[model samples]
Target: MASLSHLNQQLLSTNTLPFTPLNSTPSISPPTIGFRSKSFGRPIVASADVSRRVVYVHAVTSDDEWGPDRDVPYAGVAVAVEEKPVETETDKLKKALVDSFYGTDRGLKASSETRAEIVELISQLEAKNPTPAPTDALTLLNGKWILVYTSFAGLFPLLSSGTLPLVKVEEISQTIDSEAFTVQNSVRFAGPLTTTSISTNAKFEVRSPKRVQIKFDEGIIGTPQLTDSLEIPENVEFLGQRIDLTPFKGILTSVQNTASSVVRTISNQPPLKFPISNNKAQSWLLTTYLDEELRISRGDGGGVFVLIKEGSSLLTNQRN
Candidate 1:
């Protein structure tokens, strides 16, 4: 018998019915009970505010079923990686020159492109590292240098064509003393039946750090016929004696940068020329390139000599 309006208000205040506008339909939901403490058989209900509070929770999956489609938020700032510096022109040139010398093929030919490249590199290097004259220059030349390239007109044809019958050069040493210098060259040549060894000695003077004068003094030629199994020929007796062969004299003039030079010398006397002739000295520019272990000198007439240090290998060791 309670009023209908009063009953409706009671239902709405208790949350049993949802409030709506006058023209809208009323919404109904299941009844919610507040959590209460239990003592023996009786129940003590909690406050109405506690029952009205709503909570939401999100669950995270432990499996990888949603891994590909999951949206992951980055927790760190982005960073960039750095790169190495580029090589300089000088470094590239140096590498190219070294490759030309110690590369697969042993020697650089006079007319080849590699030789031209070497010449260009030498010029650039000399310009960058200009060496002073006299003291500094002579000190630099003190060490033993293996000849890696040479172009002396006299010896090139014989070495290239293998017509001189020379088997190998045992040793070629240039020793500079305080007052004088000596050049000793030992060579082994193949004879008709056996091999003969010959040693040539030359004395020189360092006129200045940039200039040198060389004079051929004596030659110790071995007797190949004596060692041969065949009967000795009467005409071969000259090989036994230490012949006072004709002396070869020449002057080498180096440039200020210590990179190239010019040589004025009489043509070397032929091996058979006894009582050597005093031929007029000829002048030619010699383009010289040197590092710690190798020495390359090219003559204007297209002769090349490749010499290496006494104990060094052609490939692994090079001048710094």
Candidate 2:
């Protein structure tokens, strides 16, 4: 009687062994030799003749490699060979939070389950790794972030009925020695009867690593001019008020200045005059949930904001 290991090697070397595709039914040929063992019940061997006597064998191959070779059982063999990565609880929680905001439009409210999951994940993540020092805050918050979800009630009114508007936000970034921070926002409203874009710039202060105060010193709010392919309606209302773009034509226009005082205010050092306003500055507490990807923040008035990093394609696709 031939050893099972030797028989397996012979079967593999000779390409004549039957192999069924994965998840396919195995065709059974008449067995020419029946090898019976005390350990492994019955082994089927296919050959040209079926009138052979049964051979009892005492030796068996290693248990881990192959099973009693009948007609190559494809279903169980394929699954055991391929390995899958083990997902951790933290990973699952983070993925759930990302899925809640990914591809979601501005001003959309998250579901209750999503909100709970995000809160739990943020709590767990922060507990494991404390917030970085105040000096390290600017490095993480310097890039452009696209609005994903906001708990602020005011933003919901910006969306008319069932239309998704485009909201792009440039953050207020500052170094430790930097005294001022600037934020630029552009929101495009496309309705059935009107299409308009409102852009604004605000100067702010970073009090600490977790806190920022934004002052709306200067801004330009109006409807942008449309191209030949697009036209604005006769009447347009944004944020529950009628919009007049004529007065905002030169409101926030940038001008070159050689003055040293102007250079101190802007981070990019572009010489421009920014007039201070009497309006009070609002404070916001930032909580970064994912590095360079997602952030959750709350205003002094208890409104929450979720921001996601935007790619260059998002800016290019915006309507002028």
Candidate 3:
């Protein structure tokens, strides 16, 4: 009998082979041959016939640089040669696609449009929305005045030392020194209240809808020695009413004496506990009137808008 390996070579040339099983391992059937040519990307081979003890096998290997060298009758081997079938372009394409993204991570998979939609929805939820102002101050601002906003200069050394004082009403201009602050209605008032307020440390805590507590450094009130939160009510107006000074929108009208600067801003980010999502964008409405100066700043944390108005108010109107 010809060598099984030699027979395989002949089968390659003749393109004719028969299905059969191996002699030794009848249970171990003959090896099936898979034909893969440079031209045929995908080739399907037939299963061996275990009963015959003879079969044909095909394989391409660069290291070997050839098919099975020569099939030999070693260990009860039965070999038969057969023809390999050709694959169509469509079959090749389908197989290629399946291998690319099917079972494996790289295999062909389903569309992600649903995921895209979800991502888009999330983007809308996290989107930066411009707060709508009740009024724009374009017409109300023009000329040099005392600019007073939240201070970037931190606390005036002595301001936090002790009780501050409410001073005689001073001219509102761009030059209120650090020691000139007045408190009224629980909100501290800083000087140089122009389109901007700079350099006087102003801090406030919103304890409740009916109560807000604000504190100014002692030195910022012109009379740093006697200023106290208790006496703040005696100097400024609107002492009894609950006040809200958040800005929902508006641009900067002018600066008192500072260099050309961007307006500040305030955000109305609801607590995460409130549970707001893209589906409820409109429900989480932040409404306010913008008739004041705003200060805009950029730093490590992020940008913030500080509403700087001698006297302005913000309201959250319920959404329809």
Top lDDT hit? 2
For model 3 the local lDDT of residue 287 reads 16
Put down candidate 1 lDDT per residue, 1-320, tens digits, no spaces. 33434433433454322232222233443232233343332322222211334321111111222222123221211122234457766556545555556531224244567667666765665444334343235544454544444435465443443344534332334433423456555555564434455655566565543345555566666544222133322332365865432231111112211212111121222243123233322223232434444444443457654444455554244432
Q: How should the candidates be ordered by lDDT, best one leading? A: 2, 1, 3
Candidate 3: which stretches are off by over 4 Å? Answer: 1-153, 156-158, 161-305, 314-320
Tens-digit per-residue lDDT, 156-206, candidate 3: 222232233432222223221212222221222343232111233333343
TM-score of 1: 0.40
User: lDDT per residue, candidate 2, 1-320, as tens digits?
Assistant: 55545565554444333332222233564343333324344333322223222222222332323354444332211111223457766555545555555433443455666666656765675554334543255655666676656656766666433344443332221212233467666565554323444555666676776666666555454443222222324456889999775554443232222222333443233223345566564445555443554456667776666655666332333221
How high is each candidate's TM-score?
0.40, 0.46, 0.16
What is the alpha-carbon lDDT of model 2 when measured against the actual structure? 0.47
lDDT (0 to 1) per candidate = 0.40, 0.47, 0.28
Candidate 2 — which pairs collide?
Answer: none
Best by TM-score: 2
Model 2 TM-score is 0.46
lDDT of 3 at 202: 30
